[model samples]
Target: MTRRHFRLLIPVFLVAILGGVVWFQLRSPSAETIAAWVDQAEIALSNQQWKESERLAQLIADSGDREAAQLIAGETAYFEGNLESAFQTLGQIPLESRWRPRASLLAGYAAFRLQQPYLAEQLLTEAIESYPKEVDAFRVLSVIHYDQGNLRVAIEDLQQVATLAPEDARPWRQLGLIHRDFERFPEAEQAYAQAVQRKLPPVLEAEVRQEWADVLVRLARHPEAEAILDAIPPEVPMTAERMTTALAIAQVTQSPEQLDAQLAQAVKQFPRHAPILRANGVRALQRNDPESAVKWLKTATQVDPYDYRNYYELAQAYQRANNATAAKEAESEVKRLQALLTRLTELSEAAMDQPWDAAVRRELATLCRSLGKMELAKQWEIAASRCEQAR
Candidate 1:
């Protein structure tokens, strides 16, 4: 199979989700609005009588009281997973009065859910500006920035959410991750520690601790990170995530023997995992045993070529072994990965971040030259330029 494509999503570890949402409830209750609409709709909506509610909502929308019945219908449609209709319907309500803040916030999130990033940003920013106390609007804006790879800005925006609602753990967790990526270890440690203090369960605490370990590893405090890893019984849940942490530490520290031991332990526990097998190849690669590494990486591709990076690693192994022919075959598969890295590079420049994407492309382009494929180098350069243009 030809592996000549280049792309990458955020790495699983680095890509953190903002899980806990702290929605702001206005001190002025909706009880007054609900009272106004009681005759047309009801005190509460029943899922079974959706059509009744929709009809009543249309009447309320016609009456122009901002009663929120129509908004309820739209939100219901969204909750039911009728995404397109929900977006279309939600956009029509004129939320110019008291409900404007809530309406704009929901509309922003709906646009985001509909995959219209620009509209989402516009609507969410409007909501937050109109009602600076509306915490959810900042959360949604944080998402828009995060998807565009503006992690520092994303963290900045999420921090606004915490400032608006200081008791929320979600923002702290998110801030912790962004800080970790930026190598602000003390800040990351403190943010994550605050998240832990918020009484996140033992299960999630372990996950957060694993994140802490990653930050510690980057800071070259492997021993402290390892202590966190050692606290959990190996028999508990999140074994794969735990193993991934161990592997990262060993790989980063160039402890091939330690890596080998971790892989061996993981294999005994879960022999069939493709990642475990791939980790073995990585361990061998670290030790400068290219041929030996290929023995495992090839198996990894055979099991799952869709991963893309496995083939890239396999190509690296071939190059290291000095088997140029085999290396060329593997190198051919890197185009897609190259394209992806090139795009990431462009996005980074546009966001005024580091030029990691460009650096990655140059590295890949250099490899193409090594394989005597200058056309590939030019293609990558063009891709890089396109990214820069987008930036």
Candidate 2:
């Protein structure tokens, strides 16, 4: 070969060698290097540096660190609201791996977030069986059952959690909520009392106290309810809800003149409040002042047009006043509203099977408007609107 040709070949050979070195550096990292990367990713996650953590986690996964990589990737996807990806990623973790139980728990959570309660139940049950000590998995399984309308099963799951973690106030609180939902006031009161005895955050403690007071009122133990309400610290301002509870206590415990004074104060404080207005209307009816009842109830219907109870009360007032025409009209409205509520409930159940259906959401909004659930109606309307916009 000529000298000039040889020089050119040497330069090309050197370039190839450099390219090979670069490729080697970019290949799958060693086990030690991947472990170090995993540590860095965990630190980034702890610091809430999500983007850096995601990048590092992806790098580790690509380097063949499947167990830690999939776990971190799934968790990152969950935090980022990528539910399907999170579920799929976490499901890839082998059952033999130490991370499997946690992966199953997270995957179940992702399924629940996706509104697949049945799948969540399945996954969570498996996780519970695999790691009987996982309190969080049991808790989430209970919530899934509750959301699916399996109240009995939900209660049973919570009982298991209580047995497993007796010191945890959350299980007791959940039991109280379930009892309250079923209107088992005595059971609710007992559960809430137990929860109150345990360690709880201040806000949660206040909520439990309020709910317990409500149960006391239901049992007609007015003095007990009042004591519970009075114990709430001054730092927790008397919200409209607390005011309503206070009014209930006064209604049961106070004399006529004192009740009137309390009602007047409530009206002055919460002018235009629907519950207070409804209370006044009911009181007028009980006093046999049909004319006054009609007047107050009419105003309430105007202020909160969707409450079926107000229409029913208005009908009774009209009947008492011998206004047959007005009574018939109000009664008809009550029946119509009741029928609409029933239809909406059926639609809501059906929609649960097809949660992304915009038509169902729109129908729900219409029904909610007729049932005095105005805020929920607005939410349904917004969801329908978003679906339409996406389309």
Candidate 3:
């Protein structure tokens, strides 16, 4: 600790301090210039002037206004479906910047679009925790939580989002989803009803109506729900869809042979709708004439192997009828469709408490073993593992 050494260290310490200060100063944006550009770019985006917004973002990006530029660029790139690039670009924003929240939020969404679930989670969590007021983070977080089969967490995440955007129809839609996942049939019905009442866009409103009807059927309140739908005649005369709903109600209520009679009428009217045909197959399942159901649904699978419900019901029918050969075949188709549905439901957690998912998996495993397909049974055992995790 000589005086000479101390004096020499002071210069180095000052240099280090000065360099740190300069680095921080350099990191901050030119607020006036960035703000002007941000305003202009926002107007451009609102007016659908993508070209102008893109140009401004690129111009600022080149000038080292990294945070602002990255935010705008990510938004524009998302518009164009260049999600990977948008995620990478937006993720580069310095952590402490004011625009960092927005950048992280955008990056999370871009990562989701690019199918990078873990990355989406990390980025979105940071954005949400840093800016709890931002609804965008909650929206993305809800999906992430749902995909992991944590429906409770998903519900909590979406609740915050609903509070943040009470007027938004999306919140009500998400609320319906939470209720459905938990098998809270009555709550789901009300949530979807609210979504419909919110003056949503027509297409979305129609979808809400369908969802409401589904929850009603689950609650065994079929007649009331169908009456509600019947009151609102479809914009395009969707008698076919209404028929399918009616058939669904009959199936749920066990209104003896009602579905059978409806099927004949359905075939006479909207004979082409696969859903109606599938309903007929389901009615056959209820009749204890599994062989007839198997015979009919076999044709159904041939016509549409991708409809998992039909295939699953058909497999159940074959099993009930003690036709090991046909049951195993139908079940193989069920597995393929289940795998596809799992992939599609990645964000929506399509597997979580989905009524038929676990039943189908368990039956598939059982059928494989009964049919002497030991290896297939083992594969289905693995599928059962996945189904448990989803719950």
| Clash totals for all candidate models | 14, 0, 0
lDDT of 1: 0.68
lDDT of 1 at 128: 79
TM-score of each: 0.54, 0.66, 0.54
Query: In lDDT terms, which candidate is top?
Result: 2
lDDT tens per residue, model 2, 6-119: 998998999999999898778868778876886687678757898899799879877766798888888778777788999999999998886787788879889877866667
TM value for model 1: 0.54
Per-residue lDDT of candidate 3, residues 1-391 (tens digit): 9999999999999999999989877975577878788778867875789889878887677667667777787677766778887777777778988888778887888877765656777788888877889887788878766654556777788788878987777878878977886678888887787777676776566666777787887787888777666656467345676677777876665456665776888868986677777777777777777877876777776665557777888889878988889878878877876775454345234334442255555665665555445675675565455556444
Between candidates 2 and 3, the one scoring higher on TM-score is 2
Model 3 spans > 4 angstroms off = 1-93, 96-99, 109-115, 143-152, 174-178, 201-203, 239-241, 250-261, 270-391
Prediction RMSDs, each to the true structure: 20.1, 8.7, 10.0
For candidate 2, the 10 contiguous residues with the lowest summed lDDT are 382-391
Best-to-worst lDDT order: 2, 3, 1
Compared with the true structure, the alpha-carbon lDDT of candidate 3 equals 0.73
Q: Which residue pairs collide in model 2, if any?
A: none
